[model samples]
Target: MNKEETFIKDLVVLTPDVFEDARGYFFEGYNKNKFSALGIAIDFVQDNQSFSQRGTLRGLHYQNPPYAQTKLVRVLQGEIMDVAVDLRKDSPTYGQHFGIKLTAENKKQLLVPQGFAHGFSVLSETAVVLYKCDQFYNKASEGGIRFDDPTLNIDWGMELKKAIVSEKDLVLPDFANCNSEF
Candidate 1:
């Protein structure tokens, strides 16, 4: 496995070594010791998965301090533009966002640390996303920024007017109005 740091602190892209043959391919998605060796010592406690169709957008979501989560996100099938935004008040990259194209073919994963909001837009006919969280989810701590917050100006790799977003996400606060407690 290999780890590459993103410009933002603590956020990284991890590529696992895959052994492919005539049959198929295999790679260890997670190995505690291996990750610790790479300076990522997260003890993930929950796993979440979602399925979406083309033009579907989800997130800009995060949890408050007590339930803050660090997530390892990957695409199981199809493709998506995964995004993470720094919400850490003390960090140099606060309010900045990073976006990456994650596809089943690439087998890459994004390690999103706490103090950030995450979201994705499907780019294929369909997509299945799986993510691991270091903390169990708490509804009370749920919060998010609008996906189209002008301050963030994230290019979700799709047209916002045609993007399918949930009603809750549609009403999320903008970057300036969000009460992030990171």
Candidate 2:
């Protein structure tokens, strides 16, 4: 049996079985049974995809109680430095963060368990990303910390133009103003 790897509690780095030859390569994007065997029992309820130009950053986002989400996030094309910060006030690892390079070449997925804030920065000419969420989005419960919030000190790929953010996202309260327990 292949040894599974862990990146943090409930977070993992899955190396799919890859088959390669002169015909190029092939690998399963997901194998639910394998994931289950590895102890991830997530039942993905929603799939989301986004395209961003290089230097764009999205998130540091999470939902409040009754709407928290767990995500399996990956890059399909180009590259990105993905990040997730534990926000569960009750979790032992709260306030911690993990960052990883995600690219088409690497084919890695990040498991962002509930109570983590997620974000990423495009590092290639463009990036196409996809994610599976365990819970449906609840607009009213949406919460976020600004990508440049000094307290979080996230280095979102640097001194480039401000990332294009939806107007709604632009108006979210900073961590200083947030009162959510998670």
Candidate 3:
């Protein structure tokens, strides 16, 4: 396995071992024991999968403390530009965002620890993003930063007209003005 550092301090990119032959390909997609060896004792409680077409921007969302989550995210069928933003107010790297390309071909994964919001945009004709969350979803604790927050200035690699989002995402607070729930 290999690791890559992002702009954010603790966020990391992981490339796991993939076995391939004339038949097909396989990999230990997520191994608790292996991750535990790396000092990550993630007790992932939920697994999620989303299928989206190119230009679909899903989130920058997080649940508040007590229900805040850490995630191991990767692409299963195509490609996506994954993003994570630090939200711990007392942390040195607070408010910063990290991004990476997670694709089926690369077999790369992202380690997004708690105290951060995560999101992604599909970069291929279509994409299937799989994620393991340490916490279950909590509606009341949910919070998010707008996908186009100027402070984040994330180039989802597509213009506004081409990108897609839900009504809730349309009114998410900007990073600059994000509250304690941020």
Measured by TM-score, the strongest candidate is: 1
lDDT of 3 by residue, 27-107 (tens): 887888888787678899999999999889998788887888888998989999998888988878887788888899999
**Model 1 local distance difference test score:** 0.96
Per-residue alpha-carbon lDDT of model 2 for 89-129, expressed as tens digits? 77776666788888999888888888888889888999999
Give the per-residue lDDT of model 1 (tens digit) for 43-138: 999999999999999998999989999999999999999999999999999989999999999999999999999999999999999999999999
lDDT of 1 at 58: 97
Candidate 2, TM-score vs. the true structure?
Answer: 0.90
lDDT of 3: 0.86
Candidate 2 clash pair list:
none
TM-score, prediction 1: 0.99
- C-alpha RMSD in Å of predicted model 2 compared with the true structure: 2.1
TM-score of each candidate structure, all chains considered together: 0.99, 0.90, 0.94
> Once superposed on the true structure, which residue ranges of model 1 sit more than 4 Å away at CA?
none
**Distance from true position, residue 74, model 1, in Å?**
0.6
Q: For model 3, what is the error of residue 141's alpha carbon versus the real structure, in angstroms, after optimal superposition?
A: 0.5
The most accurate candidate by lDDT is 1
Better of 1 and 3 by lDDT: 1
